[model samples]
Target: MGETSLRRLPLVIMLLAAGCARQAPSPAPPRVETAAAQLPEQSSAIVVPVTADLRMLERGLDANTPRVLWTVDEHRDTCVRGKRVDLGIGKVKLTPDLGCRIVGQVTRGAIRVAGAGERIDITMPVSAKIAVRDIGGVLGETATARAIVHATGRLGVTGDWQPRATLDIAYDWREPPGIDIAGQRITFTSRADEKLKRVVRRLERDLPKEVAKLDLRRQLGDVWQRAFTVIELSKRNPPAWMRVTPRALGFGGYRIEGRQLRLTLAAEALTQTFVGRRPADPTPTPLPPPSRVAGQPGLRFFIPVLADYAQLEPVVLRTLRKLAAGGITLTGIGPVDVDFGKVTVYATTGNRLAVGVTARVVPRDRDFPATSGEAWLTAQPYNDEGSQLVQARDVKLAADTDSTAVDLIVSLLDATQVQRAVALALRHDFAPDYRKVLGKAQHAIGARQEGDFFLSTDVTRVTTGQLQVTGAGLFLPVRAEGSARIDYRPR
Candidate 1:
């Protein structure tokens, strides 16, 4: 009987060993999974156009005309040819007399601008009056005379002023002459009379010298200099950004609309994001080819933002610590200490964002101890109207732990609540920073003055596109759209 009992004990011992081996827990499932987020190859671009109206040119010309152009001293020399009759004899003689003086004033007429083969053709009508004293030879030295002349003309301005700052300006006259001497009209056939021709020649030579005194080249140079000046776009902490390039400049021709001339100055504004203190003036580059689009001008550009996970990890950890500090109690467990291991952000099947979270949970109660688990959360990102930020919405748990204790803890934790809290915190903390940077950028893209043209930009809308994973961090493509208004009012 003792031998049989020993045999039974061996079998019982074998059964007990088998049961213990079966009951022992398998190695705890991996705490967390690492993931890599993918990004797109190409990003969008920003386009900005600058346009100028010709009517502004007309206004500038009208406003800046000088009232008194030329003045002659009271005692100036006068030369004139006269026919003297002695005993019914007619003879022509040239006489020079003293105490002669003249004064001329500019009476401007309609001004027009035309586009002609890379040059702007400006036509201005000249209506001027000259007061001449001592016009009736030495015998009639006290006789006074007045003459009014009218003609159409153009400014002899030649050079590549649009691309380069070089400008050569002179005066050139055009069309048939209309002259009135003492209210007596003179008609010229085939050729002007000797007196009229002499007066016209004097006008052709003298007017340009007076016009040159205006020094339009220098005025225009100052305008172009301002145009080429660097315009700031964003004002950040250490470095600022700016728009540095003017790609194209040309006339889109002109048209007469009602009482005004509508001229178009087409230009393309190119921008590069620069981050630093404002630098010295850049050398002027050759103007780009003319822009194809006509009429109203606007600008477009693309801004790429790197949302690195490494930088974001601290934010997440801080949020989790705050939640832990507030004391989160699971249904079956007392208050627990929650510590996150590694967090990974990646793109899922549908280009959505998936955040993989690894966590260690230790119950306050001495009986329950500690456990490891993972949570894969799926979320859709969108631009929030309330906060104006790239925010996560529709947060859901994709995968989590299978351990009974951990599973119960996760269930009570409510992935939706956790994800919502994270999304709110991220948006609240990060959105204002993005807005501050963008506001500085918008202010930096200020108004510019070029010649008679005043160009200003208004950023109408700002929006964000999809989020992608990159080696540097999470990449977000932002777009800004705005209109550029160019007014011609010389200052």
Candidate 2:
């Protein structure tokens, strides 16, 4: 309490020597979650203790046998002594002989015991903003530490505390990077002793329980183990669920002019989050056009087409997300073309279905006779629709014996082919409703060409089992029925 008593306290002196003693290794590091990475709600905790050696202090000072130095040695005789701070533990009695020097103004509030050769000084308020790197054992040599502790400055205790009454204890020891004592306080309460015993007893029982719970946590803590396995595998290799196949059922020369490419996308095996209600897209409405581009040369045509750009899902099915979501987007393109006297365009996609179509084309000069009948254009002799197509009459030459008598037969044939094929094209554009579980209905289109000396004959037959191409992209329905009108100069 008074300056005289502080100086009277027995000092525990220590000196460290590199050749003899060494510092103990610090605790191991643990896993950490950065701000960028997501962390779970719970974390693990730890437990440890605090201890000190009165025996080692006595050996360092050789209290029983005083060392004989050079007779004139003034250093050890004039010991670096000062009024040291005493650490009292409850009713623990601090003997008045622990003489320690009060070192450089308790900067960090921790105590230090330093030894240089035979010179020993019990440094009080041992902590500092910068750490004292070199600290050997009490033997004053670099050797292993006889003891280690997990004490904190915030607990009003950081050094090796000697318990005159209460045993030095470390409870609920969590790895603290900084002095984060959530709520630790020391009160000279009358019942504090009773409270400490109760808390210690309860914690002794509850800590083992908490520790037991964490052991279970180490088991059930990671749910991503199985999920991430599939994800990582998919990153290195393709997933088994996704399969994409592309195909086209072309209508050959029956297309209005040059063949048009119509793309159809079919996806399957998708997560429920991305799937939504089926939207029935508007079919392309037909608009009439000129029989031929006046003063236009060569059998070339312009074809304008469109496909479903309206995405049904929230996120787009890119290569990455598709693999992540474990879904497939089957994409394919097909084409159908018919020759007019000039460039022509037929078949295009709207919001969902490729609906409208038109083509500008110029037929071959009428040196050859033109085929008659819708069946003739769709027939094997010129029906390129079949795999083994027989191009018997891909084109014919112009026979302008006169404007009226000259061959308009080729034009008639081209017109018939364009009509039937286009009807089929529109039918193909519609997509099946994805909402229902069942597949789409069937469809088909047939055409027959009839001819008379008076005018050319073009007949059409449309048939369909059922169709679901309501919201899908443009296509030539393999099975569908519909008819289209094509005239020879407005016959």
What overall lDDT goes with each candidate model? 0.48, 0.20
Worst 10 residues of 1 by lDDT: 37-46
Which prediction has the highest TM-score against the true structure? 1
Please give the lDDT score at residue 11 for candidate 2: 18
Per-candidate alpha-carbon RMSD to the true structure: 11.2, 43.3
- TM-score versus the correct structure, for each prediction: 0.49, 0.16
Q: Model 2: per-residue lDDT, tens digit, 1-491?
A: 66744442321011112112323211111212211111111111100011112233323323322222101101121112223455664343332222111111111122223333222223221111111111121111111111111121101111121111112323221221111111221111222224334433432333223223222122211211211111110111111111111111111111111111111111111111001222222222222111111221111110111122242111111212223243222111012122222211211122112211112212232222222211112111112241111112222111222232222222332343333333332221222321111111111011222121011111122222221122232111122111222121101
Cα error of candidate 2 at position 83, Å = 31
lDDT by residue for model 1 over 1-491, one digit each (tens)? 57855555643454334334433222222222222222222211222322334455545554554433333334444333233445546554543333334444434455554443334445455443444545443322122222334333434333433321122223333433333433433322222234344444544454445434334355444544455555555443324344445545554544444434334455555554443456566577654444454434555554444454556666666776677677667654557777766665545544446565667677676445465555566666555433335566777666544432234224423544467666664442345545765676677665756665566777777776655444444445456667666554546
